[model samples]
Target: MLNKNLQNTKFDIRFFILCSIFFVVTSPFASCSAPPKLKTQTLTITRFDKSTITLVAEIAKTEEEKEYGFMNRKDIPDGTGMLFVYKKDIHLSFWMKNTPLPLSIAYIDSKGIIRELYDMTPYSLAPIIGQYACRYALEVPQGWFSANNITVNSKIDLSSL
Candidate 1:
């Protein structure tokens, strides 16, 4: 009877250990809290006059990221641009609804050429429309394009990404 009782206690201990192990392994996934996002790469772009600008871009690979792109970002670091990627080529327009940072947006073509550029004010909520349909739009600090002489018909190199 003592041997049987010892065997039962061992089984109970083993069961408890297995439960603890399962919780340790799977608790992270079961938690509803979202993990912090990770950045993959830093992008470097050039102006029409050959001035270089280094930007840490947030990749808009998903629909949600594209939709909520830079909406609440109050300050964008100088010499950096936010790169927005779309699944397909379409007419893209951005408004400063929730954005509180002054920005200059560049509409890029499929060949990574700047099709249009616009300087936008912070917290305006006014629609900053693109002149032509583009596959991507890059947001930089206000007057960055003009200051660097980056304009329409200028090519943007994405080889660094």
Candidate 2:
């Protein structure tokens, strides 16, 4: 009688284990039926020589805005950039700090001429110190200007901004 009882207990345990595995294997497909929604905004920024590079830009205007740049965003759409507008052109500097995207920053003077360009790696907090006074700084994906043939002294169109 005791042997029969042990065998029944072992069978019950095996059945329970099989049920657990079946549930675990099937749960993932049930929950992964849809893609998660994301938030996005529209923006536009132009470049020199009247050539407009329309893109979705995340604008950073104030001190708070500058401090919290694009920290959490993983992917930035092609032709989109982050624009940093300041009151005056001065010795401006930026760091990778919390920014997770690899970017190239174009430093523009008050006249909107491209003064300099710096390529920054993701999560690098080193300061992007500018040698001259700059009024605007445009941050785009690394090699964006080079790939688009944009260079220093090139004119950036911002009449629409």
Candidate 3:
């Protein structure tokens, strides 16, 4: 009886230690899992001079996708951005909740003309609201619009989206 009890205790201790090791090895990776896959399309911004700049834009069309937009991202390459599509024109608002990258957003009207632009601070919770109803919003790395001379009334070619 004494020998059986000793063996049982040893088994339980071994099992607990193995479980602890597994949890320790896996917990960090589980929390750092890869981001969800996103669909991409090309978007072009046409200036009044007829010059155009293009970007590879990730499409955020679903409610969940929109809610998760750019959160926790460490970097966004130049000439790349996220385009948010809505079912109807709305006075949309955005915030930088958990987003680490500084970005500038353009509010595009249904006619594909940009109506407003905002430079968002990283990790800011302050709401950035569109001045008018917009059907789409494009977010790019900070200073992208200014560097490219994109501004209000600049047209976006979203035919490829």
Question: Could you say which candidate leads in TM-score?
Answer: 3
Q: Candidate 2: worst 10 consecutive residues by lDDT?
A: 31-40
Relative to the true structure, candidate 1 reaches a TM of: 0.67
**Candidate order by decreasing lDDT:** 3, 2, 1
Give per-residue CA lDDT, model 2, range 20-101, as digits (tens): 9999999967733332232233533344554655556676777766766666667877787778889877888988865778
Residue 120 in model 1: shift from native, Å?
A: 1.3
Q: Which predicted model would earn the best lDDT?
A: 3
Question: Alpha carbon lDDT of residue 79, candidate 3?
Answer: 92
Cand. 2 TM to true fold: 0.66
The local lDDT score (0 to 100) that residue 19 gets in candidate 1 is 100
lDDT of 2: 0.76
Q: Candidate 2: misplaced stretches above 4 Å?
A: 1-52
Candidates' TM-scores? 0.67, 0.66, 0.79
Error of 3 at 138 (Å): 0.3
Q: Tell me the lDDT of model 2 at 24.
A: 94
